[model samples]
Target: MAEIVALFLALCVQLLALPVYVLSFLGLWDPFCKKVFFPFFMEKTMVNYNQKMLRHKQDLFRNMMDFADPSGKLSVLELGTGTGTNFQFFPPNCRITCTDPNPHFKERLAKSMAKNKHLEYGNFITTPGEDLSQIPDASVDVVVCTLVLCSVKNVEAVLREICRVLKPGGAFYFLEHVAAERSSWSFFWQQVYRPTWALVFDGCSLTRAIWADIEKASFSEIKLKHIHAPFPWTPIQAHIVGYAVK
Candidate 1:
């Protein structure tokens, strides 16, 4: 009977943990994820991952000079600037306004901006990428987006907003993980894994045809290059880095 009681206790414990698993899987545990888990995970895992891909990031940012103000008056709008991880990549003296849907990340993003000491912080608006009504059209000199396209509900709407905010000849710099070519084994596996993967990663789709979407957007000049980045051996490592000029 003692053994039976122990087994019952173990089962109860497992049952208690089920909700967390379910919430995590459904990407609805945003508070716990953004406040606790992502802070720790991003600092440890993604920071290192991004460090490995700094060259690609640098290549994308190099075009900033082509569109930015020389007198330190450049205005930048960054979509989905969670935790401000990409703050270090921006050119010095840039006036940067950042936005993300999650309010939990605002504090951490503030702290990151405090530490960076390079760019001037403009505002931290808690809004989704699909809507940017707070920002005026053709007002920003550059818009930066990195690793954000995969999770937004409407990719095209977000793309339109990015295009709308930029000044004439303004640059849109992005680094995104894209769907692998349809013919490859990588593409096959990405399709198989995407459902559960999106569940675990807060609705991030591993198979988003982001490159094609960017290509189809209304940009006067668009140049993108496919480059493999170091992410744990997975089809998600297929990345696109470059800029589109509006």
Candidate 2:
């Protein structure tokens, strides 16, 4: 219905936007990433839209927390911490290690990170999901992925890595915008829009069945709760927030 139409229109916008982005990037007309990617998405993306969704995503992660080490001793590792939006929510007793692939935003990430200096120890590592083998197994109590898995280079490896790092009962909490429920019109728009969308955003695929893949990664205690973003429905952009216990 309306969602299908919007998806198709969004596809058209992406198709036309590709060349414009290339020409602009080449002409030294660099558009600040904040315009389309970072800041813009923080407001426009499904997970970040309603103020309630923000808290809800946090609550989902907090549920996994076991503060055995007191306020300053517990550690949480967050993936794709772009502009590091989730940093402020951590308890003063907790330290957070965050990672992202976009080195271009180091300064901005650092600036945002400064606020958390009072916390015992916090680190922002420049890395991607594939390289997470370095994090020790059973080390992190909570792994938070907020609107992040869509763009990762290797989804399968990342999930395995998350499982490896998580303590036996640790949780994998996420807020993701996933592939639309199947429909002719919705499917058509997603196919058409995918190429352009992938180019502008990080190789994010609109068609990936993220939930199924997460379960396929061999997580035994999987919990899925489907809900919509409190806005216009776009098939591939609907918000789903839930956690999987390891």
Candidate 3:
């Protein structure tokens, strides 16, 4: 009974939080997301919730680093750079242009990355992942989005912009948690939890079929790798990791 009550409360909290965060994302509240999910919040809860999720995140990072070019001269761009934790993996010679609509992140990343300012040779625009109109075409060599796809309002528009900015043969490396492939258990939990999950996590959805979405867009050479056996959001056996090239 206690466990059931706890679960119900969790769902309720997520429901209460969702609409507020969504409005913030629509730019009605500006950077409230960072305050809601930054530092300890994301470390504990999912932008979309997952149990056994953290272990897989480390593994996903490993895979992403391995996929990157060794020359370190690749021009890269990342969307939804929440805490800038991925900054450590960028090669010293790599010049990555990162953007996010969160003002808290804009300031924190600038402060945290002050020492390595020289590595970023290009412009870091203040833009959301869904709109890259501010950035010119054919400017990026690698596009990365780690655990961010779930929150974007328009996945197709962002992907279209990604294809446009990526130089021919450039790579798109991503690690995201998505709907599980096949599991009655996975299906049941995801379906049961999705509503409250997206609410508390600021529009992050576990049921999104990201691979299909990416492939449907104008890109070639899509590669996907499933992590472990279940889902990336939970380690009890839930993790998915994938990378694709354009």
Candidate 4:
């Protein structure tokens, strides 16, 4: 069965990561897995999904860019900016500050920056989303996060940091996979595979009700919708995409 195959693949991935687990005590596991192993894994498995969603992602970025002031260059702070995948979608002349907990992504991030020459690089901050202490309060015009909340240690804390860093009336744009409807078949599978999925994918929870936390985060205005993304990975097909005003 397909489920059996999926589980088998997950187990295989865990086995491959066994050496990294052993290196956890030496503080090398997280960096190595995130910067090297995970990117390689995603590139192999997510090509089709990313291709399918390309148009949708483009439209979402266009909409988010509408919030930018036409007369001035935009300032953007991106959380969990893995490989700077969203850089191509940003409007020209925008200054982008990228933040990720794993510092080892610098090499890949630099490569992406080189490719997206339209956008200006503000610098990379090696800090988690929950604690953005290096960025001054109300410093950025827009904050962006994509496929990131599921792995964060505390979503609420990250949301608070987002609100604090954005200027008044600034926007928070996000695209995230979340829990499916409670009674759906996808939800059932999500629950069944969650433990293995989290272990293999660096603690990304397949069943997080992230929209609920966003609602409680008290954004001035929120425009969000749920849709099933065309993901080969069934448990994470349910997704949400939208922007909020701070």
Candidate 3 C-alpha lDDT tens digits along 207-228: 7778778879777787767554
Cα shift from native, residue 104, model 1 (Å): 1.1
Taking the tens digit of each residue's C-alpha lDDT, what string does model 2 give over 130-169? 7786688899877888778888878898899998998887
TM-score of 4: 0.86
lDDT of 4: 0.84
Best by lDDT: 4
TM-score against truth, every candidate: 0.86, 0.78, 0.71, 0.86
Local distance difference test, per candidate?
Answer: 0.81, 0.69, 0.65, 0.84
Which residue ranges in model 4 land beyond 4 Å of their true spot? 1-32, 43-47
The TM-score of predicted model 3 comes to 0.71
The residue-by-residue lDDT of candidate 1 on 156-238, one tens digit each, is 99999999999999989989999988777666667656655565466788888898889889899988899877776676778
The alpha-carbon deviation from the true structure for residue 105 of candidate 4, after best TM-score superposition, in angstroms, is 1.3
lDDT for model 1 comes to: 0.81
> What does the lDDT read for residue 180 in candidate 2?
69
Task: Give candidate 2 regions above 4 Å deviation.
Answer: 1-15, 24-52, 67-72, 116-120, 184-188, 233-236
